[model samples]
Target: MNYETFENRVLPVKNKLFRFAFRLLGSSEEAKDVVQEVMIKVWNGREQMATIENMEAWCMRITKNLSLDRLRSNQRRATDSLTEGFEIRQETLTPHERTEIHENMQRVNEMIAALPEKQRQVIHLRDVEGYSYNEICEILELDMNQVKVNLFRARTTVREKLVKINAYGL
Candidate 1:
């Protein structure tokens, strides 16, 4: 890929890359660094870019790998901020309603963070990033059955926990 093509194709996916990294690393700064590293790797491997059919999925795979590598090297647990990827702001809602929404979002994030790594990645790629099952399978290098199974388990776990929280205030 030439510089212009790189700029057009690769640069546009930076946000998606960063978001995926953040979901894995749980730190914006680390996510930014991962994104920079991904960009450099992509640029250096431009000669082979033509062989890749899905550029966005390719970038996402790079992001996932780099983020996991960073996580393993650091040996630190990843924790998502409540504000990440959540927007409860609404001008029309009363203060009480807004607070309720924020609380619900917080609970959801906590539940997601508590999931196993594979389930977490599958859920984030499918639900938060809006990737289809095929795209998620490609990005995560998993088979379609694995992707669907993880997604189903993640969602089911979250739903069950939410029900318990609401029913018993646990």
Candidate 2:
């Protein structure tokens, strides 16, 4: 793929890739590094990338592998803090709405953080990143049935937790 084509088609997905990496690595700096590495690899492999059936999936697969590698390498460092440097965008919401959304997002993020790695990945790809099942299966290298099962389980778990929290007025 040409640089122009890559910029037009692939660069738009960078934020999603970075968010996925951030969620997995829990560090903005590491996530940024991962995204740069992923993009560099993609640019170097652009000739072969055109032959790939699904570019987004292929890119995500690369991102996931690289992020995992970074995570493993960084395990020897200080433990990851629960509070990463990620900030919620505040441009659009009114003060009251922003506070409410922030509170809800915090709770949801906590719930997601408690999920198993596979489930959290699936839910994030599907719900947060808006990836289709086929694309997620491709990125994760899982069968269709397995993707469906994991997504269903993850959604169910989140729903149940939310229900219980509401019931308890938490």
The top-ranked prediction according to TM-score is: 1
Tell me which residue pairs clash in candidate 1. Answer: none
Error of 1 at 53 (Å): 0.2
Kindly provide the TM-score of model 1 when superposed on the true structure, using C-alpha atoms: 0.91
Provide the lowest-lDDT 10-residue window in model 1: 80-89
lDDT tens digits, residue span 1-170, model 1? 78999999999999999988988998999999999999999999999999999989999999999999999999987875758556655789988998888987777888888889999999999888899999999999999999999999999999899789989997
In model 2, pairs of residues that clash are: none
Model 2 CA deviation exceeding 4 Å by range: 76-97
lDDT of 1 at 102: 91
Candidate 2, backbone clash total: 0
Candidate 1 at residue 162, lDDT? Answer: 77
TM-score of each: 0.91, 0.85
Candidate RMSDs in Å, in order, are: 1.7, 3.1
